[model samples]
Target: MVVRSLAAPPTPWSKNLVEPKIESSAFVHPFSNIIGDVTIGANVMVAPGTSIRADEGAPFYIGEGTNIQDGVVINGLEQGRVIGDDGKQYSVWIGKNTSITHMALIHGPAYVGDNCFIGFRSTVFNARIGHGCIVMMHALIQDVEVPAGKFVPSGAVITNQQQADRLPDVEADDREFARYIVGVNDALRAGYLCASDEACITSIRNELTSTSSSDSSNGSSRNISTSSMMTSPYLSQDTIAQVRNLLQQGYKIGTEHVDERKFRTGSWKSCTPITAKRESEVIAELEACMANHAGEYVRMFGIDPKGKRRVMEKIIQRPDGQQIAQPAATKENSFSGSYRSYQPSVATTSATSGQINQDTVAQVRHLIQQGFKIGTEHVDERRFRTGSWQSCTPISASSESQAISELEACMANHAGEYVRMFGIDPKGKRRVMETIIQRPGGNQIAAPSNSHRSSAFSQPQPAPTYNNKSSASSTRLQPEVVEQIRQLIAQGNRVSAEHVDQRRFRTGSWTSCGPVDSTSASAAIAAIESFLSEYEGEYVRLIGIDSNKRRILETIIQRP
Candidate 1:
């Protein structure tokens, strides 16, 4: 392991300063960066481009058999100091047998426990991740404690405490769900522990070959558990068919689509008996298969395969779980006549043959009309794929350029009508129309003014004006307006449109206020401290206004 430090000496009085300490058995790739106060335990594999910078606030501690995968960035919390009971600093403390995948960030005060898998591009900031947790791709975990055995889905942002508490219910997978990932890492760690590159490769190859051969030979002789059968992708076609048949009859496929595809079924409680001791045997088999097939999977499915590892980790409920009833169609073709039918492009000429011409604009337009999306680049590559121009003719640069210019011209001529014909929403139509109109020599057609409510893209509304004669010093807020604000604050609500209106005039049941613009409301919220002092008993605190200019106030209730 290559260990270099940036630990500088502190003042004579402050006694706590340490250098980067990595165990002898640990494997730190040459490209990996280790900065101040980072401690790595035995058999830890730090992959290429991984950076562990324990520079600020606290130190970092990576536990044994943990794999810090490629491009992973772990840092000490920049702000808070979370000191332990032992008087030691707490930073990004990752537990044993954890696998932190590529591009994942762990900014500390983060405590990730044992047997956890932090998926690709996932983030952990100022949070506690319990044991056996699986945080999937693109998930942002900030300032929230994730419980043990919970699965965080892709693109899920668990920023609030309440969201964290309800995470387990959202995740279908439990402790055993991704336990295989840690086992795979353990094997990889052992290989990296070898003296040389050749030795490591040989060791891994020998182990996998032996295991695969043994498993294949003893397949019929050994008893397989339900969990193993469910997860194993290499099960016999007959067994797979039988499982699929069973699931089709009366079962809900709650697991990830990929895993479900493998088992032909999903999260079924009745499938496995918890009372039986054989479940452990199944899990053991699963771990073995995972470790053995790790290399093959990395090759077959690159990294972060199409399975719902992050999003669909939680087992889906029963098929009958609160399903909304839809009207059953008597005929197979339930779609309306308005739905456009797809057609293949007619042009069969290849661009390589130099048959490409300026008439390509018409051809391109035809392709688009037939439901093709043409990008400026990769027109040559995406010809055979869905949503691409499926014409027999290859797209040349000149042809593509001309087509793009023509499309732009068409947009410039009548953007609103084009977007309307293309079934774009009101908001999207406005955006497209704005973009077109903003461009030089483009059309400036207004939005459709058919509705009662005028749009920003339609005829613009005249700005509302307050009584200009009323001086700021003499403008006293109405008694009812003060009462409305008080009631809203008491109810833990901001001065929103739901409770109060911005206008001086009353519109039906909405509580009207004296003409108060956003600037005036902001000043009013700030001056609430002085206003509360004038009151006899009620305590008041002015919370800041939100982006929508809704005033937030708080009433401090006195205890009886």
Candidate 2:
């Protein structure tokens, strides 16, 4: 199982070279070593000395019935990533029926939700565990999250967030010994596929004496893709790996379809809008929108175009022996039915201050009416103009309209930078208030005075200079290339900024540091501080582009 296929060479931490989709009832182990941009899903069980690598940090997700047991070691770390329960962004996700047992070390800016159980030599770095967690033997779960159903006991260490909110909950005999190690690795993935096929022992004895078969009788061999079974003939291979993981997670690939009596009486229809953005023209317009609704039910979703919403939906064809239905994926209650879930209503929010600041809406309505809990943190404008922040994910919403609509969807998913609010204390798991709700020009920012708060987190008062009139001294960048140009202009929305120099950064030309026109991450870091104050000292660089103007990042932030 030497999967392989990312001959890396795009640096900004290896940007997509792809090829490792997996699913067709996953089972890897031929002394497993699956490489780069991995995906896996569907009854997964890669055991033998496993090493699911995604080159430097990457796509890596595992999901459906996960069980990666033997010598486990999933890697990661290039500019860290993590937000996935399919709200895209991942350098490791691993949810759905999880159980990474043996020599485990699921690294990366990881996350492990749904039915977790990492036991043997465990070590989940830059963590987040959450859903039905168990953890245990030699555990270490670093840089914490570990919330939902937590347990972690044997040699435990769970670094920070107060040892993952005092972990210790998953009982019921620790979920029946993690369901007996995922039922002995689902019977060692069906006896390693009937010891490499004898027609999978008559398809595992006709799926244990026939219960009227519903797929998974796998007499082995079936890898599906021949251009997704000749242009998606009714998708399914987990909806073509969730439409190539939501078009490599930058979203927008819709399709809908109805008829199973208007999908049980409701009216989905929609299908004519993908307008392709290459994932082979959006799976050839999602196989011509499931071959023009081949007798209805279709489904497919993922449209997040800057949260006008519609994430996680999946049907991908139905009504012919109908029994598809999976769609559970929840990370803070999946965006309430999106596909333009009618988002236009933020006329600068109100009911007396909406996106925070009316003393953070009375400190998030007195911490969810005093049961106290709510967390969040964000920063941009190049990390709050160099103050840094981060954290956002831990607002398990406990009503006050689900914690102010999850704090207005975390200030509309960090709309142009700086969002705060913490409050916590749910039975002393600390942090009792720390406001700064939404800055960078919402109430036009200015709040200073925790000894002059530039949204105080201390020592960030230096770098934001850029005023040069050339006598050569204009050096600023390299606070990690201005945080990789402020997270590539906060992950696209028609970005396009530029700046060159040093013989046009070695003749690739680039120049107009213009077009960010208030897509406001501090007006695109003040257009790279007015292009390093008009190219003060040669060798500059920058350039982000997107909205199909392609070039997504180029670096060289100021050299000379």
Candidate 3:
């Protein structure tokens, strides 16, 4: 093996030529390469083609009885360092009895605890794998520390805390399987050393020519796993069938996703659009997008190219702490006439119906789960237009039913007035959301009045889709979502709208459609309706500016 020392960089703390301190009992194959400041403990086996280089991020440690299989790479960045199990800092630490299988990578600022099994071609970077964990093939573990004894399924992209917290625990069968691999490798370690005898080498040369000829004649029989030949596990039968369904319905497919933080503020960036013409090519493109955004919040939409609007949409990945449901196959003709408009299916009427607005129940549950305090505000129509809000009785509810009961009672007392629901951060003391749940008269006013409308947007508009959906007979502003632009305008806020097609959504290159003046509520609603119909099949959002220029709120009014 190319075991050698190298001079440390010219730094304040490092000033010496460092060498690898390998234990005498460890077997490092001749073809394996070991470099500066690396320590290998007793009984460890480094197979052929394994590379352990600590030249940059120095002082790597491999504990006793660990096996580094062929084609493994252990390298680290020059800057990052991880806290080791013994309370010392290390660039990379592999604890005792761990098995890093073929083609796996253990990048620095990383740690693998004792008795772990890192599967083939998997990667662990800027992260920790707890003791006895089994990370399956092609998985990615980064940025978060996995708890002890958890199991990571194949192709998992774990990059955030929420995902790391929710991983399943390792089972008894999994532990036994990992132990079996270690036992088998221990046998192979002994056998490989004895196979270096002169007689053994002579016998191998006899059939070498024949073996080469046979390999050439029957290459398919060889055990090989290449990236190009493998299908991504994330690209399942259901995803492909969904793609086919969208395409057959004369709708083009597109995808967009965002990390947890950005997804909260209604910001989404698109992935590579499925631009292929052939059926197989489209499926491949779809697969590529799914594989690329495996960990983030991904949204798939069916676009109407001619009109520039989204005809259908669904969230494929829920990164916001929602329980991930497995993708169910879309049945024949089952994908049509369902979910035409974007609405929360779960938030609608369900088991938790009578006490609160079931259509916005998901938000209430989420706010509570995130430890936000719920509150409410009320005002008459005149006060609402003047931005004056009076606080209702403080609701320190721990349960959804309790919170909703208080909210419904508050609205009942202030009937015919405007009441809004809000959630506040106890720590920061800021409102997370302030949505108007009730409007004046507790009724939908006969078609919005057109007086005081912006001259450029003076044309009358048809009834909006929001006014048509309701649980029973009555329709109201969505509980969590206000009447969007119309409600914000009615509240005396200056509303501005922006529109973008499927292509421009990727870059967030929005085109301004102009602002709605502080006019009559009907006029503002009409202006928003005009923008919606004009930009049909596109994404449209309203920015509520509170006139003083200090406060602003953004709400997506329309999306395809």
Candidate closest to the true structure, highest TM-score: 3
Off by over 4 Å in 3: 1-16, 201-560
Q: Is candidate 1 or 2 superior in TM-score? A: 1
Residue pairs with backbone atoms closer than 3 Å in model 3 (clashes) = 308-537, 308-538, 309-537, 309-538, 310-560
**lDDT of the structure predicted as candidate 1:** 0.44
For model 2, the run of ten residues with the poorest summed lDDT:
450-459
TM for candidate 2 is 0.29
- Superior candidate under lDDT, 1 versus 2: 2
Estimate TM-scores for all models.
0.37, 0.29, 0.39
Clashing pairs in 2: 310-338, 449-453
**What is candidate 3's TM-score against the reference?**
0.39
Best by lDDT: 3
Residue-by-residue lDDT tens digits, candidate 2, 1-560: 44534423445544555778988877787777776678888888888877777878888898888788889989888778989977999988988888888898988989888888887787999888888888766668788787899776555565668657855476454575476567666789778767777786877787767753432354332324244543554445655555556666577777677774444223566878877765556766776866766766565667778746654455555556242533432111121222112211111121112233333443454456568787888887654545468887677756443455566666776787767666667675655434455655553221211110011111112344423211112134433334444445565534444554543232134456666655545455556667766766653445556565655333344444
Q: Against the unseen true structure, what C-alpha lDDT does each candidate score?
A: 0.44, 0.60, 0.63
